[model samples]
Target: MSLSTKSPKTSPIKIMQNRIYELLKQGKRIDGRAPHEVRPVSISTSVIEKADGSAMVSMGGTKILTGIKVETGTPYSDRPNEGVFTVNAELLPLASASFEPGPPDERAVELARIVDRCIRESRAIDLEKLVITEGEKVYMLYIDIYVLDYDGNYFDPAVLSAVAALATCKIPRYEMRNGKLERVEGESMKTPIRTIPVSVMIGVIQDRLLVDPSPMEERALDTSVILGYDSDSNIVSIQKNTPGLLSLNMMEQIIELGSKKAEELRSILVEAVGLGS
Candidate 1:
């Protein structure tokens, strides 16, 4: 008697995902990088000529552009002494097949809010210096982030671009003319910055961690965490995306790795801002 056996067929998506996860378990990756290594990142300032300040950061296949447009605006009643800072993130359809044409969904909103808080809470820029007429009007810093690709890990690069853009940005110098703000011709000044906050994201699947996972790896991961570190080596912001329960040990491990990455990224930001690497 003869017996016939057949192997079950697997979908390409499932096979691809399995291949990625299998490599993770073996301390290997599709790109042949170290388990905790990040993709090569390059940054340049002033990509958008019309924007007062702009920067583009490319990490592997992922790319994000941040543009800053500072203008005179009214201060909020609750914080009349502070200038308004806003971050808007756009996941354009052209960037990826998943991003649709419509209002920003929860993902977009969350991305913007996280980056906004990082800059605001970290005191990256001295908002008080933006005041022109005190409670009447102040220079509002509007940061718009454009996602040009969706390989993975957009948050860290977006925040980096925003900071770089702001650091190199030029705001029009205005003086009170007839008790009204008047722009001074042929004069512009750099944004008053206090510190640069570096944000880093890590992908975790079980006890395994990847510093900057590719899109496929990110999709297969169970959890991810974002950490924002200030110049003082203090944690400024933390955002977690967990699909399953993460233990305290896992959180600490993530923190320890993230802190080191933050310091490295901050030096890159400082150099990009013309301070030094």
Candidate 2:
């Protein structure tokens, strides 16, 4: 008797994955973009008049808005001379069906932390300058990020929005009166900006790499890497999502691509804020 030698059937998901891999082999993406091409980006600032500072960023289908609120608070014990800065992110249910209405989930927390690291590590803001009084009272900046739309990549746009909002932020002046911190009426000043930080995300599938992967590509990706670069082209922060091992050559490629893409994104932010490039 002859034994059956039929191979297992291929699932639709596998077929789609194969298609993506094949396209990437030709340096093309399903979205008709080159391997190193980022989606179209649009940025606007001062969207919210009530907020101290606000910015909205749209990258492809992804949309993110960031607002800044300045208040007086005691400095941290470890860094009494430096002001306090915090980042919070909210992934609204309207942004995506997968998101649920409740407290911040892991994804939201991760998004906030990544953006925070990018800014904090890059030293984009001069925290020392925000101090109102040494070891007593200082300016506390609250950066709130809202994900209004979900495409694939939220990190890049969220960072961009936060940076833009900060770049155009106006901190209300305060003074010490009767040993109390009093807000100076009709007085405000811009935040002391030291440098701008831009992040680039690269998705990897098999041996292929894609820049700014869309929602569909994100699902097909095996892993992804996000690198944040400062104005000096120095890598300030790096985060790798999902579980996958990258070869040495792929790491080198990602670093090179990330630096180039970061510069492009930084120029857009600078222009939006009227900062000379």
After superposition, candidate 2 runs with Cα above 4 Å error: 1-12
Candidate 2 per-residue lDDT, tens place, 1-277, comes to 1011111321226666788889999988887999889999999999999999999999998999999999999999999999999999999988877677999999899999999999999999999999999999999999999999888799999999999999999999999999987989999999899999999999988777888987767767888999999999999999997676766678888898899999999999999998764
**How well is each residue in 1-277 modelled by candidate 1, as lDDT tens digits?**
1010011221225665677778888988877987878777788999899999999998777899999998888899887888888999998767676677898888788789889878988998898888888788888889999888877788888888998999999998887889878989989988888878888998877778888877667666777888888888788998885466566788888888998888888877787778542
| Clash number by candidate, in order | 0, 0
Q: How close is candidate 2 to the true structure, as a TM-score?
A: 0.94
The C-alpha RMSD in Å for every predicted model, in order, reads 6.3, 6.6
| Residue pairs that clash (backbone atoms under 3 angstroms), model 2 | none
Best by lDDT: 2
TM-score for every candidate vs. truth? Answer: 0.91, 0.94
